[model samples]
Target: MQGAIARVCVVVVAAILNHPLLFPQENTTLPDQDKELMARMREHEEKLEMEQAKLEKELSQLESKQEESSSEDGYSWYFWSTLSFVIFFTIELYRVDLTDTEIKPVEDEDVFSESGSVTPRTMVLDKDVLSNFCDKCMYTSSHENWRVREFVEGFADDLLESLRSVCDRDADMEVGDFVGIGSMFESWKVCKPLMCDLIVPFSPPDPYSFQFHLWCSPSSDVPPGLQGCGKIKVTKFGENEKGCLCGSANMGDDMLCLLHSRNDTPKVDHSPDELLCSRNTPFLAKDQVMKWFQISVTKAWGRISHKYDFEVTFRNLDAAGALTIRFRSGKVIMLNIIPVVQLEDTDAYFVSHFPSDCDSPPDPYWPLSFAVYEKNLLKHFAKRLPQNSCHLHCLQIVTFLHRKQTGLTGKSALTNYHLKTALLHLLLSKKPSVWGVESMEHRLRDLLSFLQRSLQEKRLHHVLIGNSKVPGDVQVPLIIRKAEPINLLRPLVLQRELHAATVRHFTKC
Candidate 1:
């Protein structure tokens, strides 16, 4: 910039010297007064020459300073780069990768012997490190969690009661008392926008009753992929029966009546279209069930909309009754109000889908859910376990890992159900003494190792099905206890490509 200014000054002096007013043509003579103007012009030209010289000097100094700055920046860059590498190396030495068996040590040893030989030692990660990690990432704030749960449960109670009233008055459906299930109720929830699962059992009005056909039964003719699934047949009770009758003959017209009654015709109030059954067949269709459920929930929410301070809407159209409630404070909560059919007063229920389910079974074949029983079993085990058992902690950590893995790799076949199943299996197999809080790290390692092996073998079984290890106090259904073991990973195993991807995902976890 200074160099350009010096050139501009030189140009200005030349223009002034050649100007007609300042300096006339060389061949022409100047007047006396003009001579004085010429002297002043010479002085002005000298001052311009001095200013140009000063500017050139300043430009040279600026160039020198810039070169110095460039050299200094290069040195600073090298210094910081080296320092960053050293810091990274130090951190890696102490860092523990959860998937690895042991933490890598700095160099190969901590110290050198006097004989110029290296002394090696094993560097195991401290148990406190794992404990701290669980506290940091695997657990949720209990007080905050309770606050949210209280608000959610209170809201849900009102909403569901309103829904029950609506269904009883307007539809052929009779909604019963809802039973809470899933991780939130089980008390191992870690991931957020707080979620809650509810099993809302319902029955058909008047003469209609559900007839469950289990795949595990000796007379079942279900497909191979339909293991652990059952079809619900909508059957009509005989005209004579007015209440919960014991005999199958009194329940449906398909069977011959045992007791004598004067009435010959069944009193049916609901049409076939209004019911959840298929057009021709008596079996309940899942698609129709979802459609009916979505519509009923909408109407129910509409009825109680004025009572609540939040807005409720369906989270996913494909999911039957998945709802999201948004508060004025910008807080959101997810609630899954699953309509289920109780398996003859047992803890198990026939559900359309589980909260952790990634895929839906074929239409009309509802999968059996023993979530309530599982929750009970956990409670039973908790009482028997040593004080401050690490079983829940282990479960939380594995589930956290599964969540993180799912996020990294979008929509894997592996799910939270698989992780929970693995934990339950381990709990049943191992002694209660092994689950003490101090052994949390070991238990977590074992859990992961067990999960990895199970994924490899593709043989994670249903905990309540054919499990002789289950405690009698847990009250699992007798039929489920006697049935053949249903492998949960069978679907993943059948599809070779999917199974491979699922295994890779678990390994990463």
Candidate 2:
């Protein structure tokens, strides 16, 4: 538009200059045609000027319209952006509210298939509800449970100390430090009985030491049923034979300690008869130990019976040291004081029976217990896991559920130890981040699903034995870690009815 206006102005100026009206030659006369042409040029100049003014006005209007349109676009963008942010915030608040308030029964049909079996893949947990229950009922956060534990443990300590003193004074068996194990000590106890499982390690007096013969060793001829068991040999130090009395004086041909004359009959001694081993055998015997322990406990209680108003009695005659203490206030606390032989100063012990064993293991062979190491493994992971981790919570919840289910359906092949084993396996397999307190529900579901799969496969291996996933920081003996993984669910393989019952119990749980 400007260019056209400029062209018109140039034409007008040229026409006026060439007309001889503005810059005239001297003595020049204009003809009529020339005068007419000058008037026409003036008219054309006026028209061009008007057209230039109209073009300028249109340019100004177009610029104003463009500015208005840009302003409207800016307002629209801001409005939409603010609206989107508000909507997102509102949705987040609603979602959180639902998560907190929504609580549903776990036995929903969506968790199972039409065939009434749990479909592991589609299973889900109501995180908020489960977490709430765990925090309220399962964890040791309750003051009543804590106080009971403290009171029971304090009384038990005094009781065990008295028992140790009695054993040392009257019997040859010397009680060592008591190792705390099981769910109570592990801070996962969720049910009644409020039991404290203690491993009382005892050694022989004076010159005696324990020699362990593990079934996993190359020289072992142990039966298949005794896979995780061992035989403990009571041997005397500095002597080739077990409990042998032959000394240096009889080293050569004498074959007898001879500080006296030959006619002085061999010093009659029957102390070996009082030892923990079987008659005429160096191997430790479970029956002998139990009998001796029962007597010792009775004597110990007799000595301390005057101090307390509670009565302590054997919970089971078959179990070596299962005791129940009943207070005058009607509070009953169970104590399992298992006598164990330490395996070469390691965390492992050759226990008379595993707490989870359903049948009595053979008397000659003692089952190996990694309970101490299990406790240590949990402590080792404490630093690695998030603060207030849900790992233990998940375990407690499952075990509590299993206990309730068992009460409803009677005994089954599944045990608490199996549930704990499954949890330990998941702890190793999953990342530490997965065990945060916020993830309790998810972890609980994962644990159940893992158990379901293990049950289906009929294989739930021991966590400490032959498990490569265990962290090196745990104090597991190298031999046990390298040994073949023993299946905790092996009974299910041999007994189909037991397997079916166990599966039903687990599903109900």
Candidate 3:
């Protein structure tokens, strides 16, 4: 029975040694079993290590994906955030401030007067009283007033000095020859005793008659015969009366006597012949005087008359010759004394034939010559005259020259053609006159040249009218077209040209 117990115990010991949980065993003692157990543990450990490695790799991949997603989201957010900030900033910058601010009130007393209510001081500035006051003050303070006063005083002193010099210059004249006084107004009374009583009696009135008599004497103390130094009788509607017979006697005889008396009344020691010789000599001669005079007279008459309608004749007489004046109204006056003369031969000749038939139809040659002279004269004067004066003269010359050119008497075919050509050329030049023959020829040539060039360019061409046998070269229409090479190879082309031929074609249709 002890041997059986020993076997069971051996088995129990073996089983206890093979158990893995048992800690007191030596493992090398069982070779195959130990090898097998070690192989299983090694396999399990290798499996666990591989599994951990795979898990770690998967976690790293997941982390990398998360980080990439976060970076992309951050970039997107930053882009959107920057754009939104810029938009907000721009909106803020463009916004307007509508806030209210305080304003200080203006003081009324600074602009207004100290009346109980506001006075119209500013409005009164435009009033006449204020304006006049300001004007007066300005005038008083200006240099013009002082200058005017100085001029007046100097003029008065100069007049007195000139009179004294004149008296001293003429040694033959005594102090009594010239009665000097303080003023012309005061001298009248002082010389009243020496003055003559010239009585003018009213007479029968007539529409064309003078109605007054004029008388002059040296002193009032003289008797009838001695007082008759000068006497003139102006009668109304009598055959003996030679003076102009106006219907009225409203003016005193003193004023009329001077104008009515003949030049012979102013008698001196020098004879009319000697005085004429001295005065007739001309130092300067001017042909433009009549033009200037006409201009001035026209302007003056234009101001006075209804429409510058009047007739004036300029007469030049020899200083030594007998002067006989005749008026449109059968009044004649004769003078035996000499007059100052500045007559040019041309002007004198023109004046000698006074009141020529200038209004009548002009001679053909005269018109041409006149036109030439007038044009050249105007051009010459234009440089010397003021702008306004030159313009006025130009207008006058144009009117006069136009009249002269159009008012020729002869109307022959040759003359008509010449005039037409001249006028056309003149019109082209756009100058005031056709003045000179040379200038007219030049302008005519220029016009012909222009027309020739125009014809060559097909801009203008002559056409024959009526059934004349003349054949003229008329302008022909030229057309143009636009097409590419490919299109050009096709059938038709379309174009149009502006020409006389087109016009004629339409007219014929």
Clash counts per candidate, in order, are 0, 0, 4
lDDT of model 1 at residue 68? 38
Better of 1 and 3 by TM-score: 1
TM-score for each of the candidates: 0.71, 0.71, 0.14
lDDT of 3: 0.28
At residue 89, give the lDDT of candidate 3.
55
Q: CA lDDT of 439 in candidate 3?
A: 45
Kindly list the per-residue Cα lDDT of model 1 for residues 364-481, writing each as its tens digit: 7898888999999999999999997999888887788678878898778888888889999999999999999999877877787788778779888989899999999998878889
TM-score-sorted candidate list, best first: 2, 1, 3
Local distance difference test values of all predictions, in order:
0.76, 0.76, 0.28
Tens-digit lDDT track of model 3 for 296-386: 3334333433422223232332211122334456533322111111111111111111111222111110000112122333344345434
Which structure among the candidates has the greatest TM-score? 2
Model 3: CA > 4 A from native: 1-256, 262-373, 377-412, 415-446, 449-509
Residue pairs of candidate 3 with colliding backbone atoms: 209-245, 210-245, 372-435, 375-435
